[model samples]
Target: MTVPVADDWRPRLSPGLVLRHDRARETDVLLMPERIVVLHGQASTVLELCDGTRTVPDIVAVLAARFPRAPVGDDVGVFLERTRKEGWTR
Candidate 1:
């Protein structure tokens, strides 16, 4: 993953993929062409916000609002970089 400077629109969930939260199963799932990704914790929250409309910095802002005490910007930025590299997001 390339290092981002917060201003770049680095990643969003791939358009072909589908993200769903199964309440009964208590899981966050990403459905791909050949496999499914079961996300947890921060991954779940981050992916839930990756609707192609939010940039990395925008995501960080949203998460920060939800988690006021945590240092969400850096962490979310790093997670987004990984997700972008992983091909789960574009």
Candidate 2:
């Protein structure tokens, strides 16, 4: 799968953490260091896939099934980079 990553950073899920979202309330799954990372629709979908067990590509593949419109390749690279840089995942 592709991560739809951008930027130059990569993110990982902290061992003690899990992504939990409240769609009805619009709450987001936030990572440490950074707080209140409100996921916006598809971005949330991507972040949810950052389980650390999967590689960047794995995320993209999973997401591709849902968001066929997402940009692949470099696009995923950018997303990974930005998320990591923000210190969101791990």
* TM-scores, one per candidate: 0.81, 0.63
Which runs of model 2 end up more than 4 angstroms from their true locations?
1-11, 15-18, 22-34
Tell me, by TM-score, which candidate is best. 1
TM-score of 1: 0.81
Question: Residues 1-90, candidate 2, lDDT per residue (tens digit)?
Answer: 444443323357655555677576667756444454556656766776776667776766777777777665556667666766655566
Number of backbone collisions per candidate: 0, 18
Best by lDDT: 1
Query: Lowest-lDDT window of 10 residues in candidate 2?
Result: 1-10
Error of 2 at 60 (Å): 1.1
The weakest ten consecutive residues by lDDT in model 1 span 1-10
Q: Which stretches of candidate 1 lie above 4 Å from their native place?
A: 1-6
Error at 18, model 1, angstroms: 0.8
